[model samples]
Target chain A: MSLLEKISDQATTLTPGERRLVENVIDSPTSAALGTAGELARAAGVHEATASRLAKKLGFVSYAAFRDALRDEFIATRETATRFEKTIAESTSDTILGELAREETQALGRIEEFITPEQISEAAQILMRARRIFVYGYGNAEVLALLMVKRFRRFGKDTHQLGTDPRGLAEQMLGLDSDDAVLSFAFRRPPRGYAALMETAKEVGARTVMIAGKSGALLTPRPDRLLAAPRSGDQDAFQTLTVPMTICNAIVIAAGLTAKEESLKKLDRLGQLIERFE
Target chain B: MSLLEKISDQATTLTPGERRLVENVIDSPTSAALGTAGELARAAGVHEATASRLAKKLGFVSYAAFRDALRDEFIATRETATRFEKTIAESTSDTILGELAREETQALGRIEEFITPEQISEAAQILMRARRIFVYGYGNAEVLALLMVKRFRRFGKDTHQLGTDPRGLAEQMLGLDSDDAVLSFAFRRPPRGYAALMETAKEVGARTVMIAGKSGALLTPRPDRLLAAPRSGDQDAFQTLTVPMTICNAIVIAAGLTAKEESLKKLDRLGQLIERFE
Candidate 1:
């Protein structure tokens, strides 16, 4: 099994000290690896011996091997920029290539840190079960939103991404029921209108999931379904950095995989309809 | 310098036979490595001796070393994929992840295979010196068009990307000139209204750049500048794969860096204006 799988498997059995050590090491490997054991443990809020012992528990011969495992995990996870703190630090750059690199790298980071296998499975079930799926993403998030529409529709989910009108979205939200769901991509704070729409969807008993940053109030209406992200913005820009979008992409994909066979059959029909339209 | 830089430097000086041999190897290492010299020569449409002589000339003791170096270059490029592709590939079960992965990977693959540094540099120069910039994208492409406005404006470029209404966009494009440039994006074939707007922008002598598929006449009112991408829809859904959007991100960033001094001053004014709005 992969080291991460082992970590997840062993997570429940671990003591609080072990859990904290593992989470800290996963999130901030470089700092703990480079620093002395005392300093690293102090920062990670564990005793020095716990830190050392945690390494052995994870199959390391010594603290160094633990650090090496952490390093390997780091290398593996770096493809998606799996840590929020690291992504924010890496966002700064002088050249366009530098900026593009940081943004793309952060996208990888957000995907690994945010997306979960359970979420994927659950979302797939929701999508497969839904009578209709309406996807909403406007401004810069449209590309991702549209991508989702394309994907969900492929599996025969009755999917569409039309939120050009705020009032229309609210009206549609009012009409939805538990058999329907809305997959939306909104970051930082979505337009004020979306909050009302989200509220209406919940009031009318729709399953609503969103990919957004930390703004607890916006999600108060349907807190259980919120897909929270590390908040990021450049003032006056309509587009958020792509790290969050990448996270959404991963979740959406996982959802497709775990969806029911019946949904796949429906998706086949929808695919045919689309071909007719073309 | 990196390996690509080294290979590119040598690329200019190599003869046609040598260059053909190098290009073929660089393009596909695994296939080239195992093939016999005669087979490889036929594959590259060259004489057998030419392949052997070219290999030896590059300082390879045997065909194996030359094959290994080319393989190394391909591996180096694939390393970028390693960070994200496996996880993405695994997520492709019945969920949205499969379509998203298939599309984005295809898009990025096209970009890696086709994008030129010259095109990137040219796009940067255009954005850097333009008297004014008008961004246009429609339907799907509108997401990116709106983003360029935010990103370019941050650097203080007087940029705009609102295309929901063709008349409004056309009216806005009225003031464009040769000194000004119209940055636009469209994939596949858009509505006639978009083409009409592009035509108007040209009639006004505005320079044009595009991120599109089908090339030239396939897209009307074609921009003087082109960032072309393959037109591959995912899951039979009429949704773009986002290759051009990614390229747009790169162009915006490169332009921002090249025009940093101006962008900085523009950002200061923008801050004050935004504060007033606040």
Candidate 2:
């Protein structure tokens, strides 16, 4: 079995700290494979001893042995280019569109299995109650950040997109307080400022909700709410934004429903403004 | 019958110019209803007389009479608040996630019916051949534009996101030529600088591809290639990014496949750079 499956099989037997370390391993095996046991514990907000204990619990002789197995697994599964080659070999030019549509449809169908309604409701509640909202997405995820800003602003929430530059991000985070909330989108590898952003939010006592791909489960000092799912294919394939975008849609809809009268009023006001200006 | 149904039924009988007007009406019935017949004709890149003939061919006495009917239809269906009410009434907090998933899945399933493989190949070809790519997405669409830029850049294409400011947009447009391509996303209502962007592309002889929601059908002078589809539910309902995002995925994948060797090399280089810097 893979290291993740082994951890899952032993879930009920783990101590709270060991569970956190297991989460770090499952969420980002790539990092777990590359980093030391100490780094893994730090990321999972647990003691280093927990990592070694978890290693023994999972049938490894030592933490080093467990990480060696993880590194082997990561190397076996992290061939992204091979995944693409397989996809191309399986699909011709004529069939690629239909194939991709099927894949996306399947991904959308499985969203409910991985993400629960309670998670959506709780995240929406956070968004609704926040005094101000900051959204963070880097690389391709920046699009999702922009989208969250547009939708929340439509409902009359004061929302801003967090920048990637260290100085700019610091400035944005400085304005954040206990009343604010941060919604971040992280896929595959975490963005450059992810750790700092999460740490700062924790320090200020601001709420955080993360919508992440499978690897996001490893995020250090996990957010108050984390919604993570795989995007259609295995980790090595070219991932699309369908699953995360659906989660965003659900949160936005749920949040709107939670604050219906006010949201509708704000939407109507937006309509009027658009009519007058455009 | 609804005016759109009537037009669809007699689609084969429309002359080339009249067909353009029909496309305008079907694509943006709101614009057709809110604007004058001359405006519709101008938007469709057809003569004003073609609008009148299209109205008559669909059995209306004049374009004004046809537009009046469209206005009534728009009013009857454009109750955005009512749509939200209906959605909320049908779904409780417990079922919103599942409900939205079903809605999005249905939208993704119908994508192949609306967008053809030939279209995907053609758009991908344009991206591969273009000297540089400029992606234009305003408001919510800005996210999609950012995504396109990120994906195309990974494949080693020279790409840029077109800004929305008047002066900045003008300066951006000044740099375009016949060797460039502009990919735009428009939904519901066109953005303020949309007309100028399309016109400038035409004037400077750049290839243009538009991925639009239903209302984008009425874009003035139309794009060189247009891919349009509805976001499940009626026009007034809350729309998700599932459809357009899927289309974007298909195009990016197709483009990557067409230039497999070069794209793979660049992606490998990107992987190396990330490992070194990240």
* Alpha-carbon RMSD to native, per candidate: 21.2, 26.2
| Per-model DockQ | 0.05, 0.13
Question: Using alpha carbons, what is the TM-score of model 1?
Answer: 0.52
lDDT tens string, model 1, A112-146?
A: 34556466567656766789887787655666676
Best model number under TM-score: 2
lDDT of 2 by residue, B188-232 (tens): 888769889999999989999999987777888799999897775
Give candidate 2's chain B TM-score: 0.61
lDDT of 1: 0.57
Report the backbone clash tally of model 1. Answer: 23
lDDT of each: 0.57, 0.73
Off by over 4 Å in 1: A1-206, A213-224, A228-278, B1-95, B162-173, B214-222, B231-241, B262-278
lDDT of 2 at B67: 81
